[model samples]
Target: MPVSRRDFLKMAGLGLVGSGLPATPLKQIARNVTTDNAASMLYDATKCVGCRACQVACKQRSGLPAEPDAQGLYETPRDLSANTWTMIKLAKENSEISFVKNQCMHCLEPACVSVCPVVALEKLESGPVIYHPERCIGCRYCMAACPFGIPKSQWEENLPLIQKCDFCADRLAKGEAPACGEACPTGALIYGTRGEMLGKAHARLASDKNYIQDVYGESEVGGTSMLYIAGVGFDALGFPRLKDDPLTAITWPYMKAVPAVIAVMASLSTAIYFRTHRDKGKQNGEEASDGSKD
Candidate 1:
């Protein structure tokens, strides 16, 4: 059966590679202890009203220009873009409505961090996935690797840069919440430690039996700093149904192994060709010597 785009997105969200392999362990390295802690966000779609105030706040905080619509009115973006770091998507199933906020998932084992050939993206000690434009060569590989499609490029600019949510690292350092969380009128977006957020997500799922039993990000892509609680299946909200394993994990081993296999084949081919030519040369030389003697 052909996988639909919606289904593909779900798989992407779950960190499933296109190859359909099971989830694998993400590479994680421990960092030195510091007083500063990792920060995260918890998004409850059931509680979101899609007011888009959070979107406005994000633009204001990030100093991004307003997105104008056909009517020249400021409109919230439907997806994450260079000028829009956060977005809200609406989903409906069986007459039930859900609002899903979209942004960088900030994976515990971030594929972007692992795939960046130039180390443009880094998983910071504070848990936010930060992008260093200075190191970026505009490859946009991070955008391709991200399950959530969170990273954006300034395509219009001559010198493009990858853009995504930083979990408000600057604000967090000053003991401030992310603009989106602070702007959420219904407390739909909450900022805190991953542990605390996971606990809260589980509690919500437990208390609200109707909610999807799965916590979108708990183990997806080896987990994400931003979590979600959805009333409808995540698919309806544009969240891809990903395999438990990250896409990067599923694809990397094959990529790494190909070169070694090619090298071995090349070596064998070279040896065979050389041996054949050497034998022919020896036969020709011996025939010439015999002819000369005769």
Candidate 2:
């Protein structure tokens, strides 16, 4: 039997029931790790001189290869990729230029962690979004779920994997700061506890009238480990103005009804099957009566 458009949509919505993620937004499932003791990174655009030392340090520490542009002599990359975990993205507004460091936000309630079918992506208690490639099936669902678009796939490799900055989990475990934080000479990138970083970000904004009133990443997507304090507008600096609520909360209600959706689809499928069978039986009966009458 042919399926109607409405039935197709019902089946599609039903697929969410077995999608490996919870239907309801379980409070403690992914949100148990709070920022109270979590390590965090703070980027102050006002203090950044755009030296790109942090960029070099990320490659050196991770042992990732450099990605040169069309002119192979330059290692300048426009955005995050498989090789470049972190890069200084330039934001231009006429003559004045601002530098924004793009990396994993490491969200407190990370959407990647919530959506990963294989549990490959995890949010550490130390405030880093780490990936386990061995567990990863290269699904790329994490890439779609992430609001910051931080994860990059190693598409060129024979045995490819997705890569992103883990906030230097190795260094953090050893009680040292991340390579990018260590390499920042102007104190632009600071590594510390999440609470302490938030305090500093707020303090700078309060002390300096020149700084923008808003603190990027403080409450974006229910807050992130990485925070930003910039003098220029966040939009002008290419920062996305996002709602404070986690994406999970926004979509969970519909997700919770997936079973019902699936039930409706199953019933519809059965109805279609029986109806076609009945119609075929009636046609056979009509043909037999006509032959008997002749």
Q: Which candidate leads in lDDT?
A: 2
State each model's CA lDDT, in order: 0.79, 0.83
Q: List the residue pairs that clash in candidate 2.
A: none
Which ranges of candidate 1 are over 4 A from the true structure?
1-37, 251-294
* Per-residue lDDT of candidate 1, residues 1-294 (tens digit): 144434554575586554423323344333222211468788998889999888888889989987778788758465789999998877788898888888888887788998899998898877888888889999998888787888999999999898898878788878899899999999899988877887899999999898998888877756778888888998888877665555566567656678776897999999998887877977788779777755
Residue 220 CA displacement from its true place in model 2, Å: 0.6
Model 1 residue 63 CA deviation (Å) reads 0.3
What is residue 13's positional error in candidate 2, in angstroms?
A: 20
What overall lDDT, based on C-alpha atoms, would model 2 receive against the true structure? 0.83
Task: State the weakest 10-residue window (summed lDDT) of model 1.
Answer: 28-37
Summarize candidate 2's per-residue lDDT along 1-294 as a digit string, tens digits.
143433444555577446533343334323233675799999999899899999999999999989887979999887899899988977876677788898888888898888888999888888888989899988888888788888888888888898999899999999999999999999999999887888899899999998888778878878888999987788888877776667776466576769977998999999998887887977788889788755
